[model samples]
Each structure stands twice: as C-alpha cells, then as structure tokens.
Target: MSSNPGQEGAVAHHEHESREHASHEDAGIGRFFFGHVPEGVHGGLKQYGLLAIFLAIITFVEFVIILPEDLRGSSIVIAPLVILSVIKFFCVVAFFMHLKFEHGLLWQIFVAGLVLGLIVAIALVLLFGVFRPTPRAFSEGRQQPFVHHVEEAPHYEPLVVPTPAPLGAIAPAPAAGAAAGASPGQQIFMGAGGCSACHAIEGLAVGALGPDLTHIATVAESRVPGQSAEDYIRESIVEPDAYTVTAADEGIDQDFQQGLMVATTSSLGLTDEDVDELVEYLMTLR
Candidate 1:
C-alpha cells in the first residue's frame, strides 16, 4: 500500500529529532566541561557551566569559613567542612574526571577504590591513635636535669591497670630526689601509660612527641598565671583538651587534642593515687 506523503514527511522529521537528541547525550562530559559552544548555539554548555560554577562556589565558601572568628573549636565546623568536601569530590570525579561517561565496570572499580582508600586511611589513623588527644609539646631551655633511670630499652607496654585500687595500693610515695625503685607512676608512664612514647623525661621515658618534663615543674606554676604547679600538671594529665601547646615558645605546655589523652587515662583505669604519684613525679622534674 502507498503511504500518504504528509504522513511519510512527519515520520522522517520525528526520526531526525530522535537522532539529534541521542547525539547530544553521547557528547560526553569533556564536551560539557571544556568545549566552547558558540553563543546562542544550543548544547550542554549552559548545564555544564552551572555545575562548574557551583563547585567553584563551594570551594570559595570553604576558604571563607576559615576567615571567620571562632572557626576553631566550633561545633558546626566539622559537619559542613566534611560534607562540602565530599560533595566537591563527587562532582569533580563524576563530571570533571569524566567518570560519569565511563563504562559501568570501570565506574564500579573507581568507586570501590575510592571507598577502600578511605577505609584504609581511617583504619591507620585509628590504629596509631592519632585521633586521640595529642600531648602538648614541651619547649623549655636546652638544659636538662640529671636523673638516674631504669632501662626500659625503648619498649612501651600498653597501659593495663588491672583494677582501680585505692590510692595507696598503686604505690607508696618515694622520698625526695628518689633515684632508686621507680614508683607506680613511673611504671604507668613507661609501661602502660604510653607517656614515654611522646614524652622525654631526661633519662627516663625519652619520648620526643611530647614536652620534655625534665623541667615541667619549674614553669608549671607560671604557665597558668594564678594556677598552682600541681594543678597545671594534673590538668595536663587528665584533661589534655584544656590546654594547647602551639609551638616551641610554650615552655612545658603541650599540644591539645579532643579525646586522645582522655582515652589514654580512661583506658588505664587510673585511680586517685595513681594521679597523685604522677603529679608528685612531675613536680620533681624541676
């Protein structure tokens, strides 16, 4: 049967439009991101430009957030920064990286790799306890006090206080300038306390991560204005988040982190006396 001419023309026109649409879709992300389209020429440039501009705006905002006062220690900073960073990562990879145009198998591989990398990074950070509170740095004079020490051989045992016993049970107080028979506090510091890993108490712990406690007592009284040396030392042990050791000019003050030292203290089941001995030992550092 002969088809109507009008109907035939209509069918052809419809097919041409379908082909044009498919061509546009197949253009890929590169054309969307970098290809310049002539003004008034209809293509994906407008869509691409909008998305690109959006990503740019996000980056600019991240920098702007840094300039605001109270940026540090702000409750709202974490979520916004993390969420924005993730969004930017996705946008860049999906469009700018052309992952959206890749085959399904390749796309899945890229996605899996990204997730695995994040997992490994988080695991390593946790394993090393970097997320825990970091101790402040000790920046005092070059002179160090001479103290005889027990040889730990640079090995640190994970702190394991079996039970939170009464203060006297941990260890009795040592005599002044006691050089023999290390106390329970010293055991905690070198053995399970993990303080030795970051602190250098002259011939004792020898840790370089934290301040040199060799003279911590000398300046502890002056460090906190009106606070007593004993009080400052106690705060450093139990509440590392309370103070921050920014740089070398801070004397014996240490860098502060949120849960690091708290986790350490809590994990050890330190009793009142354990802390007392630790404080007493710290005071002798002068």
Candidate 2:
C-alpha cells in the first residue's frame, strides 16, 4: 500500500530525531573520558608556566637538601624532605594522574589509604618502635663487658671482666688496631647488619629481635662441616632457614619457625664491601 506524504514526512522526522539523540550520547561519552581543551587553553597553560617553574624549583631543592650528608638524622633536613615528598606526590596526583578532576569518592579512598598507613606506622612505633626492632647493646657479633664468660677450652678458664674498653679501644690485645680494623665492621653492623636498632648490650647496640650476641664468636661455634661461627651467623642473617637451633637448645623461650627472619638482600641492597665489613665485625663477636 502507498503511504500518505504526511506519514512519510513524519517517519523521516523520527529517523532524524533518533540520529540526533545518538550523536548527543556519543559526544557526552567523549567529553567524559577526554575533557575538552578549551579554544585557548594552550595560552592559559603558557601563563601557568610559572607554576611549572615553581614546581621544578621545589623538586630541585628537595633533591639538594636530601643529598647532603649533614642532613641525615637532622630534623631540619627530614622535615623539609618529607614536606617536599608529600608536595610532589600531590602534584603528580593532581596534574599527571588527573586526580584533581576525579570524583570525591576516589579522593576519599586515596586519603583513607594514606591515613591508614600513617596510623599503622604510629602504632608500630608505639608497639615495636616504628616497625623497627630495638637495637641491642651487643648483637650477634661484638662482645660486652661484665657478662659471664665461661670458656670450655682445655683450661676451662673463667674470665670475669669489668666494663669494655672505651668506644675507641680494643678489648683484647690484637695486632689489628681496634678503631681502624673494626670501623667497617661496625658500620656494617649498624647499617647492613640492621642491628643497633633494638638490642642493647654493654658496648654495642643491635636490633632486639634476637639475643645480644656479645662474644657470640667466642661462645658459639659451628657444628656443621666447613662452616665457622662467623659463617654461621652471616648465613643465618641472609638465610635464617639454613640453620635452626631449637629454642630449648638455645635457652630461649620463643621457638622460631620457618621464614621468621625476612630476607633483606633485596631491600638493604648489600654490596661486597658491606658484606665484608659485616663478616669482619661478626667474627669479632668473641
């Protein structure tokens, strides 16, 4: 049947309306993902070049402040560094990541995560001393003074000692100078060894996760073939599972299961020099 001309016109109008609606929907989606750059946004960005310059300067200052050795352990240095890091983080989030234009819900989620992390850190500081073990005076290596030292050698000598030598002097008479020979080892123990954080002995400071190892070398030796006491300790730090002494055997109450000590080869990024220092210091535990 032939359609009336008016009806044909109405059908064409409906089709045109449908096409227009589709076009509007498509435009809306495009705008949501790729925000429209205004006709002269480039000019506005040029005007905002000062913002970029200021940000660059801030970054440079942060780097310079952090690079100086004197800034280490200084509140003056740490405070600015933290502030710069926070600023940088926000800048990237706002500009590069476009978080500034994001919905409030997303921002809330991000802020919540940051707050939670800070809370956990504070809690750790209260409970476990900032997620760091307390440094022991004497760690797996190094000897302390006034501790019971019963030797099982042929003589079975019992040497009662007073306070250790001054921080600079050697306790025993050794050919190697105390300060010069043991300096690297001490640095490694404090740095790479990750000691001096928790445990405390009369002379040395080491993490308290384990026992004070003052005279560990003299008191403890390796039962395994081809392994010295020094080797045993180093291996234990690198891989705690390679050797395991029962808590009862070690005269400790806590029984260490598998995977107790976290491997820090990746985290601390120990170099050969660092390892050597650590080994040298550990051997001096006697």
Among all candidates shown, the one with the greatest lDDT: 1
1-286, model 1: which lDDT tens digit per residue?
Answer: 2222332232222223322222222123223443423222243466579879999999999887767777754867777888899888877776665554333345567767978998999998786557653333222333344447865445434543233323233233322223368776776665545566556787764555555677889978787788899999999888876765555545444443345556545666777787888888788788
What C-alpha lDDT values do all the predictions have?
0.60, 0.54
Question: Model 2: per-residue lDDT, tens digit, 187-262?
Answer: 6555444544433434656344454667667544754567878777777666667766567645776554555345
Cα-based lDDT at residue 39, candidate 2 = 23
Give the poorly placed runs of model 2, Cα more than 4 Å off: 1-182, 198-201, 223-226, 263-265
Worst 10 residues of 2 by lDDT: 20-29
* Superposition TM-score, candidate 1 onto the true structure: 0.37
lDDT of 1 at 193: 55
| True-structure Cα RMSD, model 1 | 16.9
